[model samples]
Target: MDPVDIGLWGVPLAILAGAIRVSTPFLFVSLGECLTERSGRINLGLEGTLIFGAMSGYAIAYETGSPFLGVAAAALAGVVFGLFHGWVCKFKGVNDIAIGIALMLLGTGLAFFFGKPYIQPVAPKLPSISLGGWSDVPQVQAALQVNVLFLFGAVLAVFLWWMFRATRVGLVIRVVGDSSDAARAMGLNADRVRLLSTAAGGAFAGIAGAYLSLYYPGSWNEGVSSGQGLMAVALVIFARWNPINCFWAALLFGGAGALGPALQSVGVSEGYYLFFAAPYVLTLGLLIATSSPERAMQGAPAELSITK
Candidate 1:
C-alpha cells in the first residue's frame, strides 16, 4: 500500500500486465503456425492475414456495434487467404515460401488500402475480466485485468497439444508431414491435410487480428501488427512445433516486448528504448542456438521445407 512499494513493484507489474496483453496475439499466431508447420507447410503470409483481419474486423465492428461479428469476419477472411495460398502451392514446382511472401505483401497492401476509411471510426471493444479484486494495489489490479482471448489462446494451446498427441485427425496430419509417400501409402491425402491445416491456421491469425483491433491497443491502424505476425513464425521454430511450448514461448516474447515500456513507466528513461529490442534479440538468439542442422532436423517435421 506504500508509495515506495508501488514504485518498487511498478515496472515488474507493468511488464506482467503487458506480457499478458502483448502475448495474446503472439500466442494465437504462433499456435496457428505450429498447426500449419506440423502439417509440413509454413505461412509467412500470416503477417498479411493478420493485418487484413485487423482491418476487416475493425471495419465490421465499427459498423455493426458487435466485436464478435468482427472477429468472425476476420476469421473468414483468413480462411480465404489460406485457401488461396494452399491452392497455389499445390502445383508441382511451386514453392510454398515464395507464395507465402507474396501473400504477405498482398495482405498488407490490401489492408492498408481498404483500411484507410476505418482508421477514424471507433469500434466496439472487447471486455476484460478482472482477477485482481483481492489486491488493494492499483498496479496489481491493472496487471490482473485479463482478456478473454488470452485465456482462449491458452486453452487452445492445451487443446492443440492434446489433439496432436491423441486424436485421429492429428495422427493424419503428422503422418502427412513426416512423409507424403508414407501418407499416400496409408491412403491419406497429404495435400488436403496441409490445405486444411493452413486454412485453420489462418483462422487463428484472423482471430488474433480481431483481438488487436477489439482489445489491447483496441483500434485500427497500419502499424497495429508491428511485424508480430511474421515474428510468430520464428516463435513457432523456437517452440519446436510443440503447442504447449508455443504458449510458453509466446509469454517469453511478450514479456521481452513489454520490457521497454515497463522500464519507462518506472522513470528509467536513460536506456529504456534499447529494451524494446529484447523480443527481436531473443528471436535471433533462439534461432542461432537452435539452428544447428542436427538440432533443427531433430525437432522439425520431416517434410518441412526449412528442415530440407
Candidate 2:
C-alpha cells in the first residue's frame, strides 16, 4: 500500500532483472572455463585474465569509439594470456595450477597498471534486444532487456554441447583431456590440443570482460571482475563440465548474485551485506555439492590437477 510495500512487492521482478543483467559475465566466464576444463587443464589465472581483458577492452573501446572493437581487443589479450599459460605449462617440470595462480597475479597487476588511464572514459555500449517489449510496465520491460552477449552465450552453449558430441576437434580435445597416454597412442598431440583450448578459453574470458565494461557496470576500474572469473571454476564443476549445463548454472549463480540488489530495491536494506554475500555462498555450496566421494570433480577432465 505504501512505497516500502510497493518496493517489497517489486523485489522479485527486480531480482529477475538483475539476474539477467548480472548473469552475462558469469555465463561467458563459465563457458570459457568449461572449454578449458574440457581440455584437461586447470587455469587458475583466469581471474587475472578477466581483469586484464576488462582493462584492455575498456581502453580500446574508449580509444576506438567502437564497443565491438573493444571486444575484439579483449579477446586478443585473452589469447595472448592463454597462450602464455599454455606454453609455460608444457614443460615437464611445470605445474599447471601453480602457473595458473602466477598468471592470475600477473594479469591483475597488468590490468591495474594499464587501466589507470581509462578509468574516467565513457565507452559505447553494444546493442541489446528488448525482450520485454511486450510489457507496458517499465519494470517488466527493463527486466527483460537482454544483452546480445547473453544471446550469444546461449547459442555458444548449444554449439559447444554439439561440438563435444559431434565433431572431430571436440573428440580430440576430449581424448587428450581424458587420457594423455591414450591420445599419444592414437597419435594425437595432447599438448597442442590443450594449448589451443586454453587459448580459446582465454578468448571467451576476454569477451566476458568486454561485456562487463561495455555494458552493465560499464567502466574501467581495478575491481571490475569481483571474482566472476574464479567463481566460474565452481560453476563449471556444478555443470559437470557439460556446456549446456553451464548456461543454466550461470543463470542460477546470477540470480544468487542479484539477491542483494533486489532486496535493496524494495527498501529491505536489513542484512544487505548477507544478501550480497549470496553469490559467494552459492559458489562454496556448489563446490561442496559437486565434489565426489573420491574428492575429485564428477565430470572433470582426468588430466586436470584437481583430479590428480
Candidate 3:
C-alpha cells in the first residue's frame, strides 16, 4: 500500500534499485576482466571464479556468522583460482583461453560438489546504509539502502584511473600491456606482471561472488549467477578498458539487466521476460558494430588477445 511501491511513477525507482543490486557483480567482474586484459591476458574462467566465490562466501558466512569474513574467503578462493589459471598459462604451449575454460569447469564442479550442504542455510546479510532516510515509505527505504561494496568499487575505479595515469606501477602495467617486448626491453618482468594482475583481477571477481551470496538475493545456489562473468568480456570492450568508464558502463549494464524487473514492478508484464536478454543483446550489437578484427578498440590494450 506504500505510494512508492509498484506505481507507474515507481518504474524509475524500481530500475534504480535493481540497477544497484544487479550492477554490483557486473561492476566487480568487469573491473577484474579489465585489469586482466590490461595485462594482456584473458580470463574467461571468471564465470567459475564467480560461482565458486559465491558458494565459498555463503558457506563461510553461515559457519562464521560474519558476512564480511565470507567476502574475504571468496576473495581468497578467487585468488587461488586466478593464480592457478595464471600458473598453468605460463607453461609452454598452453593457451590462456583454453585453460580458462577448463578452470571454469573445475571451479564450478568444485563449488557444486562442495556447496551442496550450504544451499538452504540462511546466513546473515551484509549491512547496508539507508540513503533514503528522508522517505517514510518502505519501498523507498529499501531501494536506497546501498551496499558498502558498491561504494568500495566506485572508489577503486577512481583509484585505478589515477594509478594508470600517475603511478609507476600503473605505467609499468600499461607499458607491459601495450607491448611485452617493450616491457622486456625496459627490464620489466612481463610474466610476473601478468600473473600478479591476473591474480588481482580474480580477487575482484571473488568479491563479486561474495556480493551475490552475502547480500542482494542473499543465497548460495547453483544458479546464483546468470553468466555475468562471461558478459564482463563484452563490458570491458564497451568501456574501452578505462577503469573510470567501467563504473558508468556497469551501471548501464545493470540498468539493462534490471529492465525486466523494472517493467514488471510497474505491472507491465507483457514481453518483460524478453527484456532479460537486453544485456546480451546490447553486447552483441556492440561487438557487431565494432567488428573490425584488424583494428584495435580506441583504448584496448595493445597486447590483448582481442586486439591481436
Candidate number achieving the greatest lDDT relative to the actual structure: 1
Q: Write the per-residue lDDT of candidate 1 for residues 1-308, one digit (tens) a residue.
A: 55335775788898899999999999999999999999999889999999999999999999999999999999999999999998888889888999999999999999999999999989999889999999887778879999999999999999999999999999999998889999999999899999999999999999999999999899999999989998998899888899999999999999999999998888889887789789989988988988887676567788888877
Local error of candidate 3 at 150, Å?
0.7
**lDDT (0 to 1) per candidate:** 0.92, 0.88, 0.89
The parts of candidate 2 lying over 4 Å away from their true place are 1-9, 294-296
Looking at model 3, residue 290 earns an lDDT score of 65
Q: Tell me model 2's lDDT, rounded to 2 decimals.
A: 0.88
Alpha carbon RMSD to native, model 2: 2.2
Clashing pairs in 2: none
lDDT of 3 by residue, 72-141 (tens): 9999999999899888877888888988899889989999999999998899989988899897888888
For candidate 1, report its TM-score: 0.97
Clashing pairs in 3: none
Candidate 3 regions with alpha-carbon error over 4 angstroms: 1-6, 293-296
